[model samples]
Target chain A: MDTLNYLLQGFGVAFTPLNLALAFAGAFIGTIVGLLPGLGPINGVAILMPIAFAMGLPPESALILLAAVYMGCEYGGRISSILINVPGDAGAIMTAIDGYPMARKGLAGVALSISAWSSFVGGVVATIGLVLFAPLLANWALAFGPAEYFALMVFAIACLGGMVSDRPVKTLLAVLIGLSLACVGVDSNSGVYRFTFNDVHLADGVQFIVVVIGFFSISEILLMLEESSIGQSIIKTTGRKLFNRQEMKETNPSTLASSIGGFFIGVLPGAGATISSAIAYMVTKRVYDKDGSFGKGDIRGVSAPEAANNASATGSFVPMLCLGVPGSGTTTVMMGALALYNITPGPMLFQNQPEIVWGLIASLFVGNVVLLVLNIPLVGFFAKMLTVPNATLVPGIAAASAVGVYSVHATTFDLVLSVAFGVLGYLLRKLQFPMSSLILGFALGDMIEQNLRRALSLSNGEVGILWHSPVSLTLWIGAVAMLVGPPLLRRLRRGRAALAVG
Target chain B: MRAERVFGLVWLAVSAAMAWVALDLKAPISYEPVGPRAVPLLYAGLMAACALTLVLRPHAVAFHWPHGKVVHHIVVSAGLLLGYAFAFEWLGFPLATALLALLLGRVFGGSWRTCASGGVAMGIVLYLFFDRLLDVVLPLGLLQPLFGG
Candidate 1:
């Protein structure tokens, strides 16, 4: 009842004409930026953050605008994934696995609407979870020390090889390569330049945007070139323009479960929508793939990841608001935005600045509703991107790729690096390697290595420290079971069948 | 499978070089308890193992290089893209973008008129939206005088 009262007061602040207008504007721009090739929520927020500050809006309104953009981008990312095989950002990668196939089958509208709906549900649920559990979840998240984090990240990486592909070894190799690439820059702890090759730009290591734009956009451009010799529309736009009752019924359970699971995962510091969505897709595949329909336009496959991605985006805000620990990469930038206002978010924040805290939360609820309303109407327009002829679309993609890659650092070197990664991605793709594991490895490599090192250092270089805690121990045992269980189960089933025949 | 073997050998050489570099990478002093070297060495070691498995097994999946004109298309496209990238800072977003769009549009089977008009519109509209509206700080370069940059 008290929570409801606080929320009502929050609504009082969020419903102000200025805050509401800011919310709509942020959602509008954010969705546009998010659908652009290679740009995502981080870019959306980061780009608009300065404008919000320069306009000198009060901290609460500025925060509301930025948060709306953050949520809007999460919805926007699925548009690119459904229309093109390329993901808008790391979090949307799993959406593309099934979404693109659905688009190819002339269900682009169904994929877009379903994704938008799932994203809204996830964001709303996560915001509710925030209201109820932010403080408690933030405290619990502290229990994840370096060892536990290392174990968890390893388990997440292991999840990829075990399920994402028929060739586990090849998937594992892709991950290993991504991890190695992550090691190229100067080491954060000791400042040792590993594989810099004396290039000043390499001293900072490869940027994630550079790697992503290269690996996805470049490869996509080439693939389109090869397959588009006949220059057909990217996908047909005919068929059901929206998901029907049965389609929604089929996807509801996966979307709901993944939303909840995704929120919890997002509450963990340093884990973001990327890992949450990836895990959600894999888990949903395991639980619901009775027809082996995952990665083949399965509506469940699309909803699961989209829900998790948006839920995780909302969940990330909890740690930032409650504990002042930035939960995800996007929130880290948001933390900087807050710093511009001379605000330090901590336990005292809710008490000290109730309007700021509660208003942001209230705006999340508002922002999500706006996103759903905005996305549903825009579904047809976004889906029509499929009908964009390659003549126009191909060049458009290239220009967008260049803009996206260059805008990150405004450096030509990153642009060149993107092309290089594109070539490598093309080759690996031809060899049947799943790029998702590679991306997951690159994203998580720094986290895993840093945690491992920190945990080891805490124990004075004792390897056993990794599994010493009950949390880490349980996680280790689970990871081992995950790795060893599938093949063993297959053999057991085969043996039982043989025995029955005998 | 034969292509996989060759690719495996390439990966093996790459990992070997990675390990060699990782071995030489050193911290000035022992500031970090585990140091930076160990983690990189671990990556190198694991990569080496995967590369070896590739060399030994080289999955029986056959790999074929793209054929003839498709190969031609790929090479030209890649070359054009790299050229656009290298020339990006010099040519500026608008000019470089126009050239890239025009050429890539042609490669994708657009008529000269369609490619030219489409390319120009894309270059100009994106620049206005991203640069003027969004304040993204793109270089005007040759368009400096025209745009009063």
Candidate 2:
């Protein structure tokens, strides 16, 4: 009953005319940005965030708009994937496998509409899960002391190192680089500068927006320029835009199962939409692909990954809102935005700022519905956005990024820093370093250090306190398991395959 | 692969430098048991270890290096971006942005006509959007005399 009342109050906040309009605008802009090749949700949110701040939006409203954009991109990512066989973002990679084939088979409209519907279903279901599970998790987290928090953060980093990339060492290196970057300012506890190098601008630490925009958006522009041409032949949308009844019925089960699976996977720290979609597609293939048409324009293949990715996108919000730990790079950026507002998203958030938390949750419901209604009729138009010349798009994005960063701090120093990071980001991408882990490390570094210090202080400098509590011990064990489990499982699978071949 | 090894060596040197500096940090009357330097030192050590691993066991991976006309395009685009960053305040938002866009458009294969017109139009529209609608104070530079920013 209490939860119901809170949700009702949340609806009251979300339904305000201004909030509704902002949500619509965010979703609309997010869709267009997501439809653009190489501009994923991370870039979409990063570029708009400074604008949101400049507009002086209240923290809750700003979050609602950004979250709507996050959700909108999930729907929009399928546009290029289905039409041109190019994934608009990393999360849409699996969609292109079957979605492109369907387009080639002249079922482009069907593929797109079904994926949109599946995405809607996934988003709605995951939002329900978030509402039901986030409070419980937040309540549990209230029991955590600094030791437990330190352990938990360790587990989160370990998960990223173990799962985010094929090379754990490389991922760990990226995380360390991020931590080093995080250390480049006055120490909050001691007020002593660590790595300022006698620069006044470096005293406040590298701004998150600068790092995010530089690493993702600016470098993306450079990468786009490296390509000779952006032209791709988009397949014509010949078939019905809406899925027929039989087709819908055939994909309903896969969609539901993938949504559930993806949501759970997303709830796990460091597991993101790409992995969720991949796992969901594999599970659907093994269970339901009896005709062996899994890759050649199968409607189920199109729906499965779409549903899972969207669900996982929503699911990634759980740890971020409840535990103050972001599950993905995009969510980390969102959390960084929240930090700028001095609103720490954790157990106390529910008590201190219920409106921000609940309003964001309520708006997700509204955002998904708005996206579905907006996407079905407008997807073709969005697909046409692919024709927007890269020349105009690239320079426009560059200008927006530069101006956005400058607008916030009104400093030329930050502009130079952004370009520097852009160069670093380009190199990192070329070297196959997992940039997400680095960003996550940067986001979590201060918290981990604070918790470690507090826990040590409590224990009079005894390191054993980190492992003393049950929660801490469990988290430490989980970290070890995350590190050791993947390789063991892979070896076992490889051995089994070798035996079968022999 | 050789690039990875070189990057690892450079990273190791950076970590060593970080550790050296961390060793010099002094915290007077610390509130916590661990001082400010401990966390950074720990990160530096861990990073150094990771860098050593990469240096020792470098994997063979191919990098996508641009060639021919692509190299020229990338260089020109990068140069334009850097120039825009330095000249932003001096050239002002409108003029600098327009020039940057025009050059970038040409690098991306847009014809001169479209590049010039589109760049100017986009610069004016964005200026109005940011300056008027969003209430952001953009540096007008040379345009300040006429526009009264």
Candidate 3:
């Protein structure tokens, strides 16, 4: 009943005229940004965030706009995948596996409408899950001491290393670089300067926006410049209508199941939409492909990944709101946005700032509906974005990123710093290192170090204090498992395959 | 050699240098059990170890750098943007942003006429949107004498 009351109050906050307009605008702009080649949810928010912040809106309004953009991108990512066989973002890669094939089969209209519906279901279900599960998780996290937090952060990074790619060592090095970057300001506890190198800008450490925009937005511009020409022709959606009732009934159950599964995967600290959507698609394929029609334009294949990615995008927020640990790369950028307003999201956010927390949740509910209504009728319009010239867009993108970075501190030094990180990001991308883990590491660096230091101080400098509690001990075990489990499982799978062959 | 190997070598060198520099930071009045320097040193050491792994194992992946005009485009745009950043306050919004847009449009293959028009539009539009509507502080610089920013 109290949850209901709070949600109602949150609706009161979300339904305000200004918040409503921004949500609509955010969804519209976010979809355009997402469907553009090489741009994604992170860039959408990172580029727009400075403008939103400069508007001097309250923290709740700012979060509302950012979350709306995040959800809209998830919805829009499927368009490019379906039309051109090129994914708009990492999460939509699996969507293209079946989406483009469906488009080729003259069912492009059905695919777009049904996928939009699936995305809507996934987002709505995940928001409901957030309302229910986030508080319970926050309550559980309240028992965590410093040692447990430190252990949990390591487990988060290790899980990211384990799940992200085959190269854990590279991920570790990237994360360590981020951690080192995080150490470049004045020490919070001892008030001692560590890596400032006599620069006044170093006093506050590298700004979170500078690093985020530097990495995702600025580097993306450079990458887009090299890959400028879009050679693939888009499948036209001429005079095609929305999916009918029969198609919806056919996909209803699988979409719901994928939504639930994707939401849970997203709740895990390190796993994000890419993993969730891939797992959901594969699971649906294994179960439903008894007739061998899974990947060659199966509607379920398109719906499954779309639903999962959207649900996973929402589910990734639970950890950020509950524990201040970002659940995915996009949420990592959102965390930086929250930091811009001096608002650190965690348990206290729920208690002291219910308007911010519940208001954000409520606005997502509203935004999902906005995305659905806008996507179906506007699918043709958005597909046209595929043909938009890179020449005009790149300069505009660069200007937005420049103004975004420059507007914050109004300084050229930060602009140069962003360009430096952009170059670093470009190299990292070319080298095939995971950029998210580095940013994740940078995000969690201070917390882990401070927690370890605090726990040690409480224990009179005894290292034994790290695992003194059951929570910390379990986290340590989990960290080890995350690091070790993937390779061992891969080996077992290979063995099974060999045995089957024999 | 693979890009990762060469990059890893440089990273290891950087981390070692950072670790050396980290040793110099000391707190005369320390409250925490771990001194301020310990965290950076620990991170730097871990980074060094990881870099060492990359240098040793050296996995191979195919890489193709864009040739000729593409390389020129990338290098010139980078240099132009950096110049824009440094000259931002002095050259101001519309003029500086217009120049950046003009050069970027050209590098990306726009004709001179379109580039100039687009560049001017970008400069003026963004200035109006960010400065006038949002009230975010933006410098006018040379335009300051006329427009009075």
Q: Provide TM-scores for the models.
A: 0.75, 0.98, 0.98
Runs of candidate 1 exceeding 4 Å displacement: A1-123, A126-135, A229-364, A490-502, B61-65
* 2 versus 3: better TM-score goes to: 2
Question: On residues A1-502, what C-alpha lDDT tens digit does candidate 3 reach at each position?
Answer: 8788889999999999999998998899888888876888988888778888888988888888989999989988899999898888888888888889988999899889999999999999999999999888888888788888888888889898888977888888888988889998988888888778899987989887788888887777777767746466999885466888888888888899999999999999989999999999999998788888777988999999999999999999999999988999889888888888888888778888889889999999999999999999988889888886776788888878888888788888898999889888988887877889989988888888989999999998999999989988898899899989998999999999999999
Docking quality (DockQ) for each candidate? 0.59, 0.76, 0.75
CAPRI-style class, candidate 1: medium
At residue B38, candidate 1 shows an lDDT of: 84
> Which regions in candidate 2 have their CA more than 4 angstroms from the true location?
none
* Candidate whose DockQ is highest: 2
Which digits, one per residue and each the tens of the lDDT, describe model 2 over residues A1-502? Answer: 7777788889998999989999999899888887777888899888888888888889989898999899888888888999988888878888998999999998998998999999999999999999999999999999989999999989998998789888888888898888889888999888998899889999989898888888888788878876654668989899678899999999999999999999999988898988999998888889988888989989999999999999999999999999999988889989988987888988989878898889999999999999999999988788778898987888899889987788778888888888888878888888999888988998988898889999999999998999998999999999999988888888999999999999
- Chain B of candidate 1 vs. true chain B, TM: 0.93
In terms of TM-score, which candidate is strongest? Answer: 2
**Which 10 residues in a row give candidate 3 chain A its minimum summed lDDT?**
A223-232
Tens digit of lDDT per residue, candidate 1, span A1-502? Answer: 7668778999999999999999999898788667755456765665455556655679999899999988878887888788767676778999999999999988988998899999999999999999998756545645678888788767655655655556777878888887888888888888888888999999988876666567666877887666643432355556877899999999999999999999998876556788899999999999999988888999999999999999999998886787665566577567656765878665557768878988999999999999899898876665454455677877776776777677666788988988889889988888888775676577667767888989988999888999998988887787777667766788899999999999
The DockQ-derived docking category for candidate 2 is medium
TM-score of 1: 0.75
